[model samples]
Target: MVSTAPFEEQAFGRYRLLERLGEGGMAEVFRAKSFGVEGFEKIVAIKRILPRLARYRDFVAMFVREAKVLVRLSHANVVQVFDLGRVEGKGDEPPAYFMAMEYIAGLDLATMLTRCQQVGVRPPPGLATYVAAEVAKGLDHAHRRRGEGGQPMGLVHRDVSPQNILLSWEGEVKVTDFGIAKARDSFEVNSEDSRVKLLRGKYAYMSPEQARGRDVGQDTDLYSLGVVLYEILSGANPFRAPQPLETMRRVCQADAPPLERLVPGLDPGLVAVVRQAMAPLPSGRFVDAAAMHEALLPHLSARHGRFGPSDLADFLRRLSEQLATNRVPVSEKTPIAAPSHLTHDVDHDRTDVDLPDRDDEMAQASRLLVLGRDLLLQGDLPRAGDALGRVLVMAERHGASAQASQARMYLGYLDALAGLPGGEALLRDGLAEAAAQGHRAGARQGRFLLGRLLENIGLPRAALVEYEACRRLAITDDDPLLATECDEALARLA
Candidate 1:
């Protein structure tokens, strides 16, 4: 066991250390809690500077300067620094500098890759584009950050390594640890080619200019980012070597391995972007991160059609119903057993139930419901929900049952798929109103749908109540298949 002795609290006042999260050669990080504010608990990664390096004035100045640079650029995808201070301690205590940054509750890309190796999993197709887009946003924020003089700070993250990129639990890709970064005018040019020879970041991700000790610019970071992307999509680095010298040589002289050949079926457009970004010559790459995003936009989007999570969820739900219930039957002449499982229910259980209606209500409700279902089939849930949700707005605009309870059921289903905690309750409320109207088919269908909603949201036991109710309603309404389905669902739940 890595002893917790190094991580014990009381080393730093106010910031109570909880557990050690990570350690680099120069710094030790901890999961910490702050005593400064009420209910202000956070995972703060503390990088305590090495005592040996403390004596070196240049390294200490550089370290603190980097922290200041990071504090100024605050974007959603960039890690935030709450505070930066010197850890005051006695003679042997080591005059350490610490940076308290927003604790990212996820692994760095390097660690994520190790997990992928452990689980034997490859990243999904669109995931690379999505991740690249987010990272580009972070890069864009950092690259374009300006000063009070209204001049570009000319900041470029020279070290864009997997270790510095964090993936949050919420699927957010964040760029962090801007240590060793260079300001356009601030960086001291040691030699004619000192820019390339300094060796600030990991060699595996270095650009050709960086490797060859040549003058580097923003395109260097772009090249490094391309290498990271290549490594992420394919399991191997674009340039690898058995020795340090060999690695540098490969970075200078080698061509990036053809990604398409390695990761077959990979998006050719994405491969092209990576190829252009990783070009040996800086001028060959995209002018900026935004340009790269635009280039890969087509490949990053969803196949069949592109839609947001809400829209996609609605589409999948409606598609499921249509195919499963024979509402829009597929021909047996088709070779496939069923629709290929290529599509996913990204936000499967989010429902957006609208208000009740009266004037031209049924027609309005029908149109909205049709629009919602069409949007759902096309994988556009937000617009679908917006269209469907307007049914209630129409109802409120006019007065009740403009949708004839069926609209409520469809809207309720949408609400559940939306992943709202209160969505099931809303569905049940709709079911109660539906039952009160004595619409047996609606009641039966509502109960059946309620069971499905419950099941989807991890309320399997509660779903049984709906399933059983659906079974009884089916029997009362002479729906044999529905009753059978209810019985089967109950059995599955059991």
Candidate 2:
């Protein structure tokens, strides 16, 4: 809330601390600018360890670990750390350690949730799914990261909550405060050499094992994320009790009420995804974050096609504008803050971003369909099936009927070519559906595939009729390439 940083506009280890953003028990964050030669300056958030704790060996080790791990991570959904250094404090003061990080000009998920609760509305499911899925994408990247010698890094955030998730006004979802996972050989993240019971993450978000102070794995983070999602969608954390111990006990023993029981008419698909992520046993959850991401993305596939409601970016922008209009008087005490669920993180906390609206996911499906079609035509059955199968599932999920039919048409052709059963039936039914839907290209391809199947069955006259139909459709569509394929087939039959 300070109008200006006390050490305003002056250099401190290649950076000028402009203003404080937030502070917690261990460190303070400042909105600073990094100055370079030739008039270069870039705004960065500098996380400076509190002078009192800078000399503590274990705390310093933890701080160094946070910086090291953050520097290694590069993701759109994860905050970036660029530099770590030390600077002289005021005369007779201890040296200050700091880590410079990416400055986000938007609010944290905690703030968003609070505001939404104030307004008595939940974030749209599209936005919720988008957040969960994007965060999962970042987690998946970190989960798969390998060390220099190709060993699995085994990095886990150990904290995934609304506070740790930042949504920029431009629609970026960034997770903050990584590097919490202990080294690969260590079984517990929060455990030190003697296995002290110092708290590491919020109890409401803790996985069952983590709450019990036992070994945790990557699935632990997924469980925490599921808790966040549950709270966002249901407006309550089922495990949160007045007492921390009670909360931990509930996390270990109580089953979460089904999403439908809490919020009726929720997408059953998404409900299942969230429930699986929060399963008490890690084995019951998704095998990895990648699987969770795949299951969640289908929910967002239909977002781009919807109208009337603004997206998450717009919601944040409007919220920012409203908060600014009501800003109360303040001064000198603000510190750079972390997203609550994951502390020691940084955020922008202001400004607006107008990200371009995402195009409907069907566009992606369309491209995959075309690629699958080309691969099928080239006799690459395995690759073609892989691509076509994905496109079919995606198209079907998003209600892209034409695309789904075309996917079916191509897959049926692949199946027949590979001598699989039910090929002819699939091709004929898909062709009928595509033709009824007025999918000209799908109909054309379906005719050619059926003609080939008929030829393989020695039905020369039926195959001739199929080839002739395909040739007419291709010519009418001015698809010379497809017409050429039909001609080659007809010539072979004759």
Q: Taking the candidates one at a time, how many backbone clashes does each contain?
A: 29, 8
Candidate 1 at residue 126, lDDT?
A: 57
Runs off by more than 4 Å, candidate 1? 1-6, 37-41, 179-200, 304-494
Candidate 2 residue spans exceeding 4 A from truth = 1-10, 90-92, 181-199, 303-310, 322-494
User: What's model 2's overall lDDT?
Assistant: 0.73
lDDT (C-alpha, whole model) for all candidates:
0.65, 0.73
Q: Write the per-residue lDDT of candidate 1 for residues 11-99, one digit (tens) a residue.
A: 57668777887666456677787764667666577666656556556767777887877789899878888788887668666677788
What TM-score does each of the candidates earn? Answer: 0.58, 0.60
